[model samples]
Target: MLINVPENVVPDALRGFAAVHTDLTVDVERRVIVRRGAPYDGQVGLVSGGGSGHEPLHGGFVGRGMLTAACPGEVFTSPVPDQMVRAAAAVDSGAGVLFIVKNYTGDVLNFDMAAELAEDEGVQVAKVLVNDDVAVTDSLYTAGRRGTGATLFVEKLAGAAADEGAPLDRVAGIARRVNEASRSFGVALSACSTPAKGGPTFDLPEGELELGVGIHGEPGRERRAMMTSGEIADVSVDAVVDDLQPDAPVLLLVNGMGATPLLELYGFAAEVHRAMGARKVSVARTLVGNYVTSLDMAGASVTICQADEELLRLWDAPVSTPALRWGC
Candidate 1:
C-alpha cells in the first residue's frame, strides 16, 4: 500500500493534541508550539523543540518540571528561529531559558540562531546539544550523528536540575553529561511514520532488518537477514555495551521506534536486561517507551548511560512534563 499525506494536515491535527494536554497548549497558527507555565520564581526555564513527527518529545515534554515551551515544526522539518524565539520569550521568567537541541544540522543551526536572537532581547540562554546515537558516528554529511532515544533521559534530568533552581550553565552541563555518557543502537524491521507515507518508509520484504537505523528512515549501518527478537536485542545492545565501561552502572532506556508495540517492546527489554545481567552490569534506573521515533518504524533501540552521582540525583528529582511526570 502507498499513501501521500498532506503537509499542512498533520500539523493542524497536532494543534488539537496540544490543546487536550493540561500541561501543554498549541499556537495553532504556529503549529505545535505548545506552552507550559514555568514552575518557580527566578528559576531558569527549559525550552526545546524540533520537528513534530517525533511526538511526545519536545512538545510532550512541556510542563512544570520539563520544558516551559516547545516550538514544533512540520513533519521531519526543523522549526524556524522565529517560533523558538517566540517560545523563549513566553517561557522566560526572571532568570533565563536553556534550549535542549538535538545535534542534527538544521536543528543545531536553528536553535543556535534562536539563542542568539533571545540574547539580543537580554534573555540569558544556554544550550545542550544531544548526540548519543551510535548509529551514524560520522560528522561529514550531517552534524555528527542524529540524536536518538537518550533525549528523554536528558530532558528529565535537566528538568530536575532546573526545578531545583540550578543555573542555566549547570543544568546544561548536566544535560551534556547525560548526552556524553549515554549511547544508543537500534534495528529496524519495517518503516512507516508519516501518515501520508503509508507503507513502510522503505521496502523491506520479509526476513530482513536494517541495523543501526535512524529516526528519519535513513539507511542504517548494516542490513542483514532477519533474526529472532532476542537475537536482535542482543545484537543492538551489544554494540552499546561494547562502547561502555565495565565498572559503571547504567541508566537504561529501551525504546520502541514507533510501530513496535509494547508486547514486543517488553520482550525486547527483557532480552536487553538479560544481556546486561550476563555481563554483570547493574541498572540504576530504566525507561522503556516510544521516546524518539520515526513516524512508525517497527523496531526498537537500546540506550545505556553510565550514570554519575549528580546525573542520578537529577534523574530522581521531580518533573511534571506532559509525556512524563513524577516526584513533584
Candidate 2:
C-alpha cells in the first residue's frame, strides 16, 4: 500500500537495488542486470527473467555460481525478447546460453523468441521450462503448473553445473531434473497491492485465506477459513508432500510471500518441520526466508525438492547473490 511511486516503479526500484550491489551492473537502457565479469569465458551461461516485483529472484540471483544475467519487465509483465536477447549475448562466453524460463505463457513466448533470435546471431541457446508449482495444473495465465519456488532450485543447481564448465545441454538437463523433482503450494492471508494496480490484486475477507495461491496474486484452488498457524502449516506441507511423493531425503524451502515478517516465517517453518517429521519424511536441508515472492503479499509457500546425493552436492555448492549468499 505504501510504494514510493505510482508509476515507473520497476525502474525506480531497480536503480536503488543496483546501487547497493557493487558486484552487479544494471543496463538501464536494456533493462538487464548482470553480474560483473560473468559467463567466466568458456563456461556455459545461465540467464533467466520474468515480471519485476519478484525481487531477489532472477535479479538477486545474478552472480558467480548462479545466473550470469537477468532481465526484468514491468511488474507482473514478462520481459521482451530484445531484453532477453541482449542479456543472453552479454553473458554468452562462446559456450552458449541456457534460458531458465518459468512456464507462464508470456515468459515462455518471450524467452522462446529470444532463444531463436540469439541463435540467428550465431549464439547457441538452450531452454529449460520450469513448472514446479503444484497449486494448479492450469491457470488463467499458464497451461501447466505455474513456476514458483522451484525456479530458485533450477537456477542454483543448473548454475552450479554450468559454473563447473558443463555444456549448455547438461545445464539445461539439470534444470529440468530439478523442476521435475520439486513441488510447491502456497497460502495467502492477504492480497498484494501493486503500484500500478493501486489497490489489492484480490480481496480476501477477514477470517479467510486462499489456499494454493499463485505468486502473481492470482486466485488459488480454493478459499478456506483462516486457521491457526499450526493448522495452516499442516495444510501447506500436506499438499506439497502428497504431490511430491518423496522417496528420499528432501530439501525443504519455507518461503515468505513478500510482506510476511521474519518472526512469522520462522514460526511457520518450525511448524512445517514438525509436520514433515510426523509423516516420517526426512529433511536433509532447509531454507527459511523470502526467496521467490509475490510483492507485499502476506502469505507463505512450502517447496519440497526431492534430494539425492547428487542434488545435495549441487545444492551445497558455493553461491553468492544479493538475496542469497553462502559457501562463498
Candidate 3:
C-alpha cells in the first residue's frame, strides 16, 4: 500500500518478481510466469492462476515439483482464458495438463472455459477444484467453500505426483484426495488494502477480530472481541479438527495473512501445536509462513491435512520454487 508504481501495478510487480528469480521467466506481454525448463515429455503440466494480490502463490510457485506455469491477472480479478490457453499450450506434454483452480466463481468459470479452449487445440486438460476452507460456505463471491490455505497442500502433493510422470487422471485424483483430507480456518485483526481500492477492504474496530475470514476480505463467520493469540489458536484448531477429524498424523500450516509478522506466525504455530497436542493429534509435518495470504491483512489461517504415508512422502518430495524450496 505504501509503494508507488505506474498505472499498471500488477504487471510492474511481475517484472520485479521475475528479475529476482531467474528460474522463473515472465512473459511481460502475456502476464504468465513459466518455469525455465518445462513441458517434460510424458509429464502432466500443472497450470494455475488467479488474482495477483496473493504473491508467492500461483506465480512464485512455478517451478519443479510445483506449477509448470502460472498466469496472473489483475488484482483480485480472474485471469482471462487466453493466458491459461497459452500456458497450457506451452506446458502440455503428451501426458496432458492439469488446472488447479481454487473454488471461486470467476476462477472456476474462466478456467473451465480455458480447458475447452485448450481441448480445441488437441491438448488434454483436467482440473482440480480446491474448496478446503471450512469457513462460511457459499460466500458472497464463491458458490461453495472458499479455497484458502489448503490450496498449497493440493499444489504440492499433486505437483509431486505429476512430476513423477503420473497421468492427468492420477494427478487429479491425488489433488482431490489432498483437498478432501484438508480443512482451514482464518482470523483477521484487520483488512488489506488493494492498490486499486486505495483503502482497506473492510473495517474492524480496535480490539476486535473477524473469525473465519476469507482471503478476499469477504465477511467471515462472526466478528467478536479480540482474544489472546493462544485463544485464537485454540478456536482455529477446534474448528478445523471438528471438520477434519484428522488421522493420527496431520500436516499443519500456520499461514500469516500477508502483513502478519513471522514472529507472530511462529508464536501462533506453537499455540497450534499445543492445542493439537491436547486434542491427541500428531503433528507429522509443519509449515509456518505466509504461503497463502490476503494483501497486507493483519491475520493468520490454520490448515490441517490428514496425512498418510503416501501423502507424507509426496509432501517431502523435492520442491524448488521462489517462495518454497526444500529437499531439492
Candidate 4:
C-alpha cells in the first residue's frame, strides 16, 4: 500500500509508467496504454485489458509484438465499455482490431459491448475469450473457468500473427487456438492487500495455503496445509496435465502471482519440469517470471500450452514489451 491515495492508485502508477516506458503512450485520463507506433496499417491491432493489480499483464505486455493497446481499470475491477471502445478506435489500422478478453463476467460483457460500438464506428473488430484456468469450472468472478497464466501465451502468439500482417480473422483464430491449447492452475501462499483495503484482502491462517486459487482471490478447489514446492508442483502439474492431455510438445509458464521472488520461482520451475517429465509430457519452451500477477499475492501458477510447429514458430517471434522481451 505504498500509494498516495486509494482512489488515485491506478492513475498515479500510470504517470510513473508513462515516464519510464517512452515507447508507450499512457493516456491517464482515458486509462489506456498504447504502443508509440500504433495503427500498423495492414497489421491487425491487438487490444487487451483487465483490472489494474495484474501488472505487466495487459499493460506491461503492450508493445510492438504483443498488445497494441490496453485499457486498465481500477484494481480487481473490469474496465468500462468506453475504455474498450477508445482502445479499439485508437489501434484499428483498417486491417481490423482484435479484442483478447479474459473470461470474467464483467470483462466479457464490457468488451462485448465495446466490440459492437467499435463496429458501429466502422472499425472492423473480432474478439477471442481466454478461459484457460483449469482450477474450477466456476468462480466468484466468472461463470466458467477463470482466465489465468495462459493469457500470456495467447497474447504473444496472437500478437506475433498480427504483427506478420495476418488478417483479422486469422489473428483471431490463432488466439482462439492458443486458448484452447492451454490450461492453467494456481496456488496461493498468502492473501494480497489492495490499496483501498490497506490490509490483506482475505484471511489465511498460518501454515496453510489455497489450492487452485483465482487471480482476484476467489475461492479455489480447497484449502490445505503448507506443502513443499515439489509437492505443490506435483498437484498443480497433475491438474493441468489431466485436463489437457497434450499430444505435442508444450510451452511452459511458471508465473508468479506478484509477490513471489525469482529465486523461489526458478526452484519451483525445476519441480514443475520434473513433474512434467514424470507425466511423459515434452516441453518445447519455458518462461518463468511475474508475467501475470494478482496484486501482491504470494503464490504462483503453472500454464501449459500444447505447441505444434506453427505455434512454436509464432512463440519464437521477436517481442519487445516491458515485461517480456526476447529475439529482438
- Top candidate (lDDT): 4
**Which residue pairs clash in candidate 2?**
none
Q: Cα RMSD for candidate 1?
A: 2.3
Question: How close is every model to the real structure, measured as TM-score?
Answer: 0.93, 0.97, 0.97, 0.98
Q: What lDDT would each prediction earn against the true structure?
A: 0.79, 0.89, 0.89, 0.92
Error of 4 at 53 (Å): 0.4
Give the per-residue lDDT digits (tens) of candidate 1, residues 115-211: 9999999888889888878877566775687788878888888888888888888888888988888888978888654655644567776788899
Pick out the ten consecutive residues of candidate 2 with the lowest summed lDDT.
133-142
Candidate 3 matches the true fold with a TM-score of 0.97
Best by TM-score: 4
Per residue, candidate 2 scores C-alpha lDDT tens digits across 1-328 of: 5567767687877888778988998887679998898657789988999998887788999987889999999898899999999988898889999999998999999999999999999889999988878878555655888899999989988988887888888888888999999999999999988888788998899889999898897878899998877998898888888888899989889999998998999999999999999878899999999999999999999998998898899899999989778899
lDDT of 3 by residue, 187-266 (tens): 99998888877888788888999999988866588999989999999999999999889766999999998989999999
What digit string (tens of lDDT, one per residue) describes model 4 on residues 1-328? 6889899999999999999999999999999999987888899999999998999888999997889999999999999999999988889889999999998989999999999999999999998999998888545655988888888999999999988889999999999999999999999999989888888888988799999998996656789999999999999999999999998999999999999999999999999999999999999999999988989999999999999999999999999999989999
Candidate 3: how large is its RMSD? 1.6
Candidate 2's displacement at residue 177, Å, is: 0.4
Please give the RMSD to the true structure for each candidate, in Å. Answer: 2.3, 1.6, 1.6, 1.4
